[model samples]
Target: MVMGFREFCDYEWFSFTMENYVVHILFSKSEPGPLLEGKSKYVELGGVYSAQLHQAHTSVGQTHIHVYARNNQLFAMNHDGSAHDRSHGSQIPNKVAQAITQKFPNFTLPKDNYIESAPSGIVNAFGHQLLLG
Candidate 1:
């Protein structure tokens, strides 16, 4: 997909970057419903997405979306806490990563740790525990 150059983050202004390719952008409950329902090609246009990326839902959950791109790398955005909290030990993350690696062996992770926004009711991501903010 072709994307126009724009200012991203604080100091990164990029027109096009091969190194900045996104494998996926996972979403939670608050995502636009049509995109999750496959009514639109927005999610699939530039990357792959899964509405059922996770098998379980948290107490305060909404729909979860996963965006997968050309590489094994993936990211989570717009996800709520309860949904992510419930899916913690479901082998989803590792499984997803494995699948991506199987297909894109050359894909590299941009960071040693994955970054996800705090959920609506969470302030931190703990081991199988998301503390409410």
Candidate 2:
């Protein structure tokens, strides 16, 4: 099955992100609040996103989309927070970096550290310990 689609986020934040296509993976030490107009992509993985990259359709000060690879494959995280265990690679990021390079020859997608920092099976149940740890 070839998924020739675009746009996705972590399961916990999947539904919310759908409400607004703009993925705002936060890096600041802040909580998701009214200020976070988009899908509230938290700082689970400290990465840098250029405000110029995020596409249109949004009402916020900053904007950028989040893309990650699990087990060397790129798939949008579900809304149920089920995609927890896997290796995060730079597959999609490589593409984005290439696209940006066309215009800004000095662009590199910031490697997401969630898969690097968090242990296996920890990405899904982050902070939601009450669910099942």
Candidate 3:
């Protein structure tokens, strides 16, 4: 089903183990629709975000990593944990990487490892097209 950003976040937060990795994928621009106040942010193309899973919370948690889109490029800002370096490059711990890879082979390490622009549709790394609605 096509999901709104909040619905997507809820699914990721509650449906997985704490050990599973999560990346908050943001598009460059907001899709045309009504966005819930304070819950969703409009994104630009090339905006990137990464976060290390801390204490698992089904409803709430700390926000980490904020990369702004500049000239269609993402530049990392100050982040909360060591998983990301100043370069905005990912430093995903080995164990977390392995678990994610095992479950989603299309999953790429270092959220920015690929050079392609983000796809407009919801598809995982394995090219599995997700029906967002």
Best by TM-score: 1
The digit string of per-residue lDDT tens for model 2 on 1-133 reads 2223334341122122444364543332233343333544332221342322232222322223343433222322211212222423323344444544454443323334222223334544473663365
The CA-based lDDT of model 3 is what? 0.33
In the range 67-94, model 1's lDDT, one tens digit per residue, is: 4444332443223422243233222345
Candidate 3, poorest ten consecutive residues by summed lDDT:
114-123
Q: Please, what are the lDDT tens digits per residue for candidate 3 over residues 29-61?
A: 324333333353433222232222222122332
Residue 78 lDDT (model 2) = 19
Top candidate by lDDT? 1
Runs in model 2 deviating more than 4 A are 1-64, 68-87, 93-95, 102-107, 110-133
Alpha carbon deviation, residue 98, candidate 2 (Å): 1.6
- At residue 86, what lDDT does model 3 achieve? 41
What is the clash tally of candidate 2? 1
TM-score of candidate 1 on Cα atoms, chains taken together: 0.24
Clashing pairs in 3: 1-132, 1-133, 2-132, 2-133, 3-132, 28-43, 28-44, 28-45
- The best-first sequence of candidates by lDDT reads 1, 3, 2
Task: Estimate the overall C-alpha local distance difference test score of candidate 1.
Answer: 0.36
